[model samples]
Target: MKDNPLVIKLGGVLLDSRDSMKIFFDFLSTYFHNYSRNLIIVHGGGKIIDDMMKKIGMNINKINGIRVTNSSNIDIVVGALAGIANKRILSYLKRNKINFIGVSLSDGDSVLVERSKKLDFKNHTGIPKSGNPKLLFDLLSKKILPVVSSIGITKYGELMNVNADLAASALAKTLGADLILLSDVSSVLDKRGNRIDSINREKFNALINDGTIKNGMIVKVQAALDASEVLGKSVQIASWKENNEKLKLLFNGELSVGTFVYK
Candidate 1:
C-alpha cells in the first residue's frame, strides 16, 4: 500500500442502492485518478444475503451481531457477498473507468481468519486475526483499488462469513492505514439533527446516556472508536451519499465534514 493509504468500509442502506454506488464510485475515480490518492474499499452485503436466504427458505440466525454460517448456507452467503455484491461495486467502478479489483477477504490471504471463537458457529463464521498486506500492497502499487467483500476463508478451506466492519479494521491495522466507515447516515447527529464534529470515549458514553445516540448508530460509533484506538488515530464515520464531499475533506486532512471518533 501507499505510505498513507485510506480504508473505507461500506454497508447498510448504502450498499443496497445503485444510484448511491454510482455516485460513490464516481468520487473514488476522481480521487484516485484525478487527485492521485490510494484507498481500499471494504463492503458488506447483509441485506443481499438476508434476501437471498429468505428466498431460498433458509432461516437466518445470529449470535451477538455475527451471523451464523454453516454447511447448508455457506454457498448462499458467498454467492451474495463475493459474487453478487462484489460484482455490483465492480460494475460501477468499471463504468467510472477506474482500475479496480473485486475480491473477498479470503482472496490473496489478505486477511488471516479462523473460526470465530467468540461465537459458537463452528467453522463457518470467521474472526479476522491478522492481515497479510502483500497482495493489497501489490494492487495498490499498481493503482488498482481493491474492493473487498467480507467473505473469508479458514485454513481448512471453509468459506466463513466475516463481519465487514471488523474486517475493514483488521485490514487498516495491517496496512497501517486510516479508516473511514461510510453508511447512509451523514454523521452522528445531536437531538437537534446537527452533526457532532468529534466524539471521544467520554462523550460517546454521554451521548449514549442522553439518548442522542441510540440503536444501530451506537454499534457503528463503538466500532469507529475501537478502530481509532487500534490504529492510534481518529476514525471517521461519514456518509457516502453527500457526493462524497466528506471523503474529499478527509483526504484534505480536515475532520470537519464527518464525525471523527477518538479512542
Candidate 2:
C-alpha cells in the first residue's frame, strides 16, 4: 500500500451476522495486520441499534430508512455503535497481536456533526464541521487506526446524525485516503440484475435518469462525488462478503469484480 491513508466505511450489515462478523475481523487480522498504511475504520450501527431498540420494546420510527433517534436513543446508539463495536474490533486486533489503536470523535476533542458552525456552506446546504484535519493527520502519522462511529457531535454541544458513508468520504478527503466502501452487495446492479463494473459521472447520471440507480444509492453516489471532488480520486465500492480471493483481487486493483464510481 502507498503511504497515503485508507478510510474504510463499514456498514451495519457487517456487524449483523455472527459468523460473517467474525470472518470480517479475521480477514482484517490476516491481511492488514502489519500492513504499513494508515487506516480509519468508520462504522454504522443501524441494524444493530435498531435490533437492540426492538429488544427493549421501543417502537421504531424511520424516515427514509434513516432512524429517527432522540436524545435517549443517542446514548444507546453510541453505546452499541461506538462502544461495543469499537471494542470488538480492538479486541480482535489485540488477539491477533496486531499493532492497532482505537479512538473516537472525542479522542482528539473534535466534532464531525452536520449543520455545524465550523462548516462554510451557505443556506439550503449543510456540511459536517471539518474537524481539524490536523487532528486526524497526526493520528495517521503515528501509525494508529482511529475507529470512528457514525454518531457525531455538533458545534452546539449536541450529538447529531451523520452518514457513515459521507463521514468516510469526508475523512478520506481530509486524510487524502484511498477510500473503500465495503458493503453486502457486490456492486450497484442494473435493472436487469447485472453488476455495474465501472462508472463515471456521465454513466452514473444515465443510470439515475434511466431509473436503474435509486434509493439508498443516492447518498452513496453523493459521498463518492464529494470524495472525488476533494481528493482527486474515486471511491471504490466492493462486496465485503466476498471470499478472500475476490477481495484480494479488488484490493490489489485487479478489479475482477465490484463497482467503481470515479471521476
Tens digit of per-residue lDDT, candidate 1, span 1-263: 23488888987786787777777778877877866567899998888999999998899986545577887888999999899998988888889898989988877788888987755555487878557889999999999999999888888887888878878988889888878888888899999999999999999999999999988788788878877777888888887776566677776555456788999
RMSD of candidate 2 to the true fold? 4.0
lDDT of 1 at 251: 65
TM-scores for every candidate against the unseen true structure? 0.90, 0.82
Q: Given candidate 1, what's the lDDT at residue 208?
A: 90
Off by over 4 Å in 1: 1-3, 63-66, 121-123, 244-246
Q: How well does model 1 score by local distance difference test?
A: 0.83
lDDT of 2 by residue, 1-263 (tens): 36677778887477767677778777776666545666678877777777788889887776555556665576777777777777776776677666666665544544355553443332111244345577777766776667787666655556655667766766676666678888786788889999888788888789889998887776667666666665677778877888877765555555547677787
What C-alpha lDDT values do all the predictions have?
A: 0.83, 0.68
Give the clash total for candidate 1.
Answer: 1
Model 2 per-residue lDDT at 153: 62
Query: What is the overall TM-score of model 1 with all chains considered together?
Result: 0.90
